[model samples]
Target: MKKAYKKVDFPTEKIRKFLEPGPIVLVSSRWEGKENIMTMGWHTVLEFSPSLVGCMITAENHSFDMIEKSGECVINIPTVDLIDEIIGIGNSSGADTDKFNKFGLTAEKASIIKAPLIKECFANYECKLVDKQLLSKYNFFIFEVVKAHVATSSKYPKTVHYLGEGIFMVSGRHIAFPEKFKPENL
Candidate 1:
């Protein structure tokens, strides 16, 4: 059976919901001894080698000022088990409350960055701001991953994906067919 498609106008406000299934990330930044963490969903990988990451941090976010000043941050990836905490972190503002204390999240020191890592996250990427060309126009800041860490025993950890308007989707089953694709390089 073939399903019929209907044509409808898309709303600009909700365009991101259809264009991308962006992963949820907790960005921790520190500047002049002040540290803060902000939950963000608009991030993408720009390169594999040199590990370039581009994330959008609007000027309104408190972390923006800290990140802009320090040029250092960490992107912490959380599994589905921390869904509630992710939502809480996204809902609250760091300017008003200490998210690390209010959310009961432990801050662990990073090896190469001043920003602290979220102890509960499955993985953490210590990053340094490498470019800011898009900040004025698109609010996108490019970062280079200096150090990376991941859990050793996580067999199938699922992470959360933002679907806009407070809706979320958790990572599910995996299907792999490595032999079907030819590798140019490792």
Candidate 2:
């Protein structure tokens, strides 16, 4: 017979912190000619060819509604220099205030999407919603990368990693390790 164990429920906040090293992304969406920016931490690459990305936004979030209606969005990858602005955007609501004006974020037109990209970000990916079934059910939006742009500067300043609550980590020096290690006697 199989043994059964009691299930334990972990706190959502703690679980989020454990999933660290996530990129700090500035997500922009436009609807009815109005555009807004929101900071997102729950996002990841899904595919390479015809690149795809998945982002989770709460149903109540204003940006989520806009993106659903517009069918387009821009994901801007930010460096540590924009940490303050990222936090501000994450804490505020686009429905109540103009986040761009409040956070001093500048927007530029995207090549393949109606949504604009953040000018201060290190890189931007213009995407169109490729899948919405998951989004409607779980508030998770999957997009196909239509176009991508990066700053001319080859050197990226420090990057920020979300660690739940008000905590953040800055990117450090790069290090490489051997792909495999062998035992001396083996």
Per-candidate TM vs. native? 0.86, 0.81
lDDT of 2: 0.74
Q: How many backbone clashes does every candidate have?
A: 0, 0
Per TM-score, the best of the predicted structures is: 1
lDDT of 1 by residue, 19-91 (tens): 1345688998888777788989889777766777889998999999899889999988777777878889888
C-alpha lDDT of all candidate models, in order: 0.76, 0.74
Q: Which segments of candidate 1 are over 4 A away from where they belong?
A: 1-21
Stretches of candidate 2 exceeding 4 Å from the true structure: 1-21, 177-186
lDDT of 2 by residue, 1-103 (tens): 1111112222222222212347778899899978899888888777655577778999888998899889999877777777778898998999998987888
Model 1, residue 162: what's the lDDT? 87
Residue 180 of candidate 2: its Cα lDDT?
55
Q: Record all residue pairs in model 1 with backbone atoms less than 3 Å apart, i.e. clashing.
A: none
Q: Per-residue lDDT for 15 in model 2? A: 22
